[model samples]
Target: MAGGRQISENKKGLPRRWRFMHGAYFYSVPPGQECMWDGKKTFHLGRGLPEAFRKWAARMEQPGKIHTVSDLLERYLLEVIPKKAPKTQIENARHVRSLMAAFGSAHLYEIRPRDIYRYVDARSAKTAARREIEVLSHAFTKAIEWGLIDNHPFKGQIRLEGETPRDRYVEDWEVIEALSLSAPQKRGRRQGPAGLYQAEAPDRPFTWGYASPAAGCEFPGRWHSGAVS
Candidate 1:
């Protein structure tokens, strides 16, 4: 019975200026008004009805409202986030939501570098704030790419709390303890590694553990020479 109705019939009960087509919601640009829609005839909203409405609101609302940071974030989440890896999609969603809470209502052009620095300072979790700012910065970059904004506010902001480098020399006992905790075990035809291979250098032997075995699990060099026999 649903197939018998005209294409227009299925769009009934939908919001004004919205259409359902090709199994997804779309928005019709007013006649002779393609300039307002970036020269597109019809915008493919999305498959999900609730999400379609959200995108519709972002597009159909007042012109000023469409240029808000929140609108940009919504568009990014709708258009960019889905193409990412599954774990990345989840993390980016969390970051975007946090950005929304901070700068959602602000107009895109009105956000400045100082405001971003202030947001960074206010956050107790500096690491999380850095990640959120990275997402926001990329959102702004995409907004510029989309012609929604002319500039990015905080792309190169300094992150004070970075990951600790593993340059410190790891003690032999530390490596032994780590190996004790999760050493490889013999399985069927394959045997567990006899020992890790260290390079010929004696002064920096432990650093190899932090990096990689010089010869791999087979230990064909200094490790067999007397290091781990």
Candidate 2:
């Protein structure tokens, strides 16, 4: 074998009659089989095993036939998925399904940023689309590390949209009104300043924002300055 070596056992515990390997390329054959090989002609182990195995091994030895997006995804599922967290594995599986549905048939080298952009545009949720691309990007990065692909399609090509922060301001009067309107029983056991502050604190300020009022109101009871409780 030009790019392969022989082994006594297959991936399973069962004994393999003949196994061959060469430079990341290998195939198994039944015991005492004679196949023609000159390191130039196509390798063939005569009929007995699945036809796909024969075809795949033959293609694996050829430089031009290597690295399909589908194959990379399959490898990622097998090698990478197990190491991920349970929630992450579920998420990645969903992303992988989408990726395969779109680009599984394409070769890894053939996929471009434009194809990815199209996929992103087709998605309804921008956040979800961004996550999907991120997952695919990670898979492509793994492919590059594994030497399956020379470059990543997403590298420096895709830009995710930024999320804006929200700021809300609540006036002290609104909080006081809400507290006054709430029933005495709903205000809990205490009728003191502590109880009113405690009852109002959870329901109001945080929902809106808590800032000192421009013009403060006088409290009916003793209350600390700048403190809700």
Highest TM-score model number: 1
Clashes in each model (backbone N, CA, C under 3 Å)? 0, 4
* lDDT for position 81 in model 1: 65
Q: List the residue pairs that clash in candidate 1.
A: none
Over 102-197, each residue of candidate 1 has an lDDT whose tens digit, in order, gives 676677766755455456555557677776776786777777678886645544333334435445565442354234322222131133121122
The lDDT of each candidate is: 0.56, 0.47
Report the error of model 2 at residue 146, Å: 0.7
Give the winner by lDDT. 1
> Where does model 1 exceed 4 Å of error?
1-65, 157-229
lDDT of 1 at 153: 52
Candidate 2 has an lDDT of 0.47
Q: What lDDT does model 1 reach? A: 0.56
Per-prediction TM-score, please? 0.44, 0.43
lDDT of 2 by residue, 1-229 (tens): 5212222211211112223333222334433332424343334443222332344434333323445666777666556654555445555656666666656666676665545554554455657666667667777777767777776654554444443332545334224423433354334323222111222222221111123445663212111234555
